[model samples]
Target: MCSLAADLATLFVAFALANLLVIGKFVGEPAKPHGLVMFAMIAPVYALLAIQAGVYGIRSLAAVRETILRACWAFAQAVMLMLVIVYFGKIAEQLSRLTFVVGVGFSLCGLILLRPVMARLIPRMIGEMPAIAVVIVDSVPFTAPTGTVLLDARVLGIDPVRHDAEMAARLASAVGHAERVIVACPSERINDWSIALKSLEARGEILVPELMRFAPAKLDEYDHHPTLVVAGGPLQYRDRIIKRLFDVLVAGIATLLLSPVLLLTALAVKLTSPGPILFRQQRLGRDARLFSIYKFRTMRSDMTDHAAAQLTQRSDPRVTRVGAFLRRTSIDELPQILNVLKGDMSIVGPRPHAPAARAADKLYWEVDDRYWERHCIKPGITGLAQVRGHRGATNAHQDLIDRLQSDLEYVTNWSVWRDLRIVFATLRVLVHDKAY
Candidate 1:
């Protein structure tokens, strides 16, 4: 209903704009713009672009920067199509270059501007929409403080509780007014949360763990037992065959093209340091297997084992002059193409962790059991974790945990196109030092 209506509106708007540009350019009559033909052609094209850009769903509220970037891409695709049409139809002479250019430029600008304005206004209008209120009950109010810190800036109307009584009162009130209620309590306070939730459930209300809270630590505090439920095995043989074929094809091609850069990096690392050129470390691979991961040496060989395992700080003393430059620019990881070729890794997957990183006591692993689930796939030379500003040493537990979450998400949504996109994104971030 409403969702379908909104989707249709977005599709129609984009199509109409694209059509105006095409028709205004092709229509021979200068005074008559052939608006009808423009509408017919542009509407379909716009709908296609909108769907491809993921503008139909909740992503329609993407930021100005994202909107502009997507619009530019859509415009480029449209221009390519128009060129093909004109070439085959012999309509180049009939089209007005000025009109086409102006029309595309106007449409792109309008769409980009429209999104940011809508992003700002739409939330206010939808603020009253159904929301899950998280009641944080703890003896010391630890859960409450942490819950407040975890509030997503984008979502509206999340209420937090400080004590059991407060949680009970809030839960009763929300049962009367809100559509849902989630209780976030410490591990020791599970009894209280369960009791409160049961009381609400007795009155017939929906409660789900997925919408409970933002703090991963709070969620993990409750679900501590390993519930072994064997559902389906790993990918079938046919799927594995297809995936491996793709890996080899892409890796082989990439190795051939990137050989020169790899050679130069090796030479640079060797000349920059007195130690070995390649830094080979034991890293956990798929199914918890160990593999030797390769990268150009970016630190002194004399560095202590503790220093190697610890996160490197900005302007680390162990970093050689050339190593600093290489690390910042990500030239140090260029040699990992050999890893890709050797079939020890993929071009895109979870970034492998050192063997020492497997300790569950580590802050990141302590956050959730799913943290190690990232190892379900081959570690990537460059991944969503690295591209999203998660590189270097993690100073805080939350940093590593956040990076792990992104890594798992990348694995769950893996695709060849997504891998290519991540590679390009890594390059852009490295060049700009956006992830340092």
Candidate 2:
């Protein structure tokens, strides 16, 4: 929020400076450009780009060099977008060439200046926020306070191969009490600890050797240690509102347009199957919340309730004739539009899994511990993995891993435009034969 406000302020400053450069002084009554609407539209896109670049992330953990680099990257991206908008929007005539150049230069300079200002203002506004304790596993010297706790790597007893009850409890207690946690260790061990602490609430950070080599491309540096925040989910307050609005608009329109097909599918299922027209199952959603997801019934009624509880093979006998066609054409998924409207799902995201969803005759969560990370965002009707042809029964361990990678990528790098792209890709694949 603060970064966005700063960007808006800097935009005005750039406008004033541009006026100064063009008219030799601020005009008493400035002429409104015909392209002012284009400028207004481009401003918010710039802010989203800035946020994605980590402009508004935890400032305490970011080094000065990293902060400046993000600012430059975000500014450059916003400027390029502005250029495209001006050319396509046919608003280039309103902006003098000199004013455009000066405006771009001034905005970049303003953003660079705004960073240090924000870094200082953010701390003061919070007013003595709680400080979390730090623990170091390695012998390497760090810049933490003089009395920070230093523990041996083996003390945490983090075993990737198996669980140690006592070690787990000990490590949990240490991090549970702190407002945040910093674990300094070798790069290889960071992954093990991260997976163990995946479900923890406290904001966790890993202290690595160098400040610039952190994963997520958005880590912060505190006292010379680059820290990747592992716990808190990324969608911020305003961003959430924006995403919900997008879901409402798209889902509402789709539900109206697809009502005929939905009705026809329901009729076909009722006639061809003895059970309910819709199959309702509990699936995990954002933050591990449970929600009932609805889809067209795709299995015969006489089969036990758990018939499709496992993966459906290529030509499963349990599948009714109508169900097979519905699944192949993805018509069975049309009812999930209602789920999107109800806020249980999104138009695009990581696809939700049933509570007992299975692959290779085993539960999905059992296949990989990292699978739980897919619950970080609202499950979507169509997702990055599904559209990329990773949908269907996971017969191989590598299949789930590949899908998980795509899901996590969508979570860490989410944007409204990206969601729209996924939606379009899904439409392109509606006729494809991969879903069944």
Candidate 3:
């Protein structure tokens, strides 16, 4: 995604440079014709390159490698096409090849260089972007102290504590001067937190938990205290039922539609390798229920058990040539549609890990309690994690954490539109080698 942004920025810079040169030549009494005409001629080619490269709609941070490759490919293709048009149209003499080459080269280099510099400088930039006032309260001084340590550096403006009524009044005054106010405090002191929360809540203030420090487990540990008995129950049975129904409907339809591809994949697996057409393995499902998930066999039958659980790195000995291709394009996962049809999976949810994959188990369990909450929904053939480039391997602890976060985000913001968006995103990733 950053690469795509770089490509667009490069294109914009190229157009801007061309326009500036043209304007200087024309308006400053030089030899050039209309400035606007030159600007129009260059801008359309840049826009075309951006569109072909899929740069315009890229998110700020996602699959960087694929985005860069796509940008480079699109730029190369655009340059070649532009050169052909200019040469054949008898305008080659009018356009300076040195100037064109320098413009393109400089623009690409500038775009590629700007992203890392901007990323490094973003913390400093946020202060200049927008400002918000935040107040923190806690019964334990250490708890509030920890809050300051965990505070987001991106947030700007004042932070006033509950201990000072004078600062609290100043905070109130600053609230109107600021764009927004955030309150972070311990869930244990509900009455005290509530009195403060209610006053803020009454004033239409937004409240967010300092989840990084005092997680749900810590909050639940203090829930029994008399002062912290704020009321809220688990998810309603009706809502759970509705979610299950939707999952079944979507998974069922997907299985039926993709049956042909699944069949062809099975045949290909059987023909290319001397092994079971489908690889079935035990995986922890919803609520830690054990279920067998299916996939087209991509590895040889002689692949070691340890290697099966471990990640298949690039150019691994176990992966057959066909297996490598299948893995790269994710055709190996097509058989999981059967699991979805059998009610063992959903069309979109958390990607299930093999029960024997101890590496995955250790990393996933290290996170906040809500890490396991992903199991509350059925496992999926394609999930937010898979779409976001979190699938295939568990080399880093952060990867598992990111996957769990995406899974939880999908659950919290569950909607038909969100599900469709996830499906489209998954398709976009699948069309290219975003994952292994």
Per lDDT, the best of the predicted structures is 2
Tally clashing residue pairs in candidate 2.
3
lDDT of 3 at 355: 47
TM-score list, all predictions: 0.46, 0.55, 0.45
What's the candidate order when arranged by decreasing lDDT? 2, 1, 3
Clashes of each: 3, 3, 0
For residue 367, give model 2's deviation from the true position in Å: 3.0
> What is the overall TM-score of model 2 with all chains considered together?
0.55
Q: Of the candidates shown, which would achieve the greatest TM-score relative to the real structure?
A: 2
Which portions of model 1 show Cα errors greater than 4 Å? 1-234, 304-307, 358-363, 432-436
Predicted structure 1: lDDT: 0.55
What lDDT tens digits, residue by residue, belong to model 1 across residues 1-436? Answer: 1322343355445445544565533333665434333334454565456455645333445455775577557656765776687689886676555555555555566656666766676668767433333332333332333332222211322132222223333444444322233343345544434434432311112123333454442322223311111111133323333445456677788778978988887788788788988888876665445678877788888882421356666777888887888777887777777787777787788887765552334534445545545654677888898888776666667777778879868766766678779878876776544322
Q: In lDDT terms, how accurate is model 2? A: 0.70
In candidate 1, how many Å is residue 397 off? 1.5
Full-model lDDT, candidate 3: 0.54
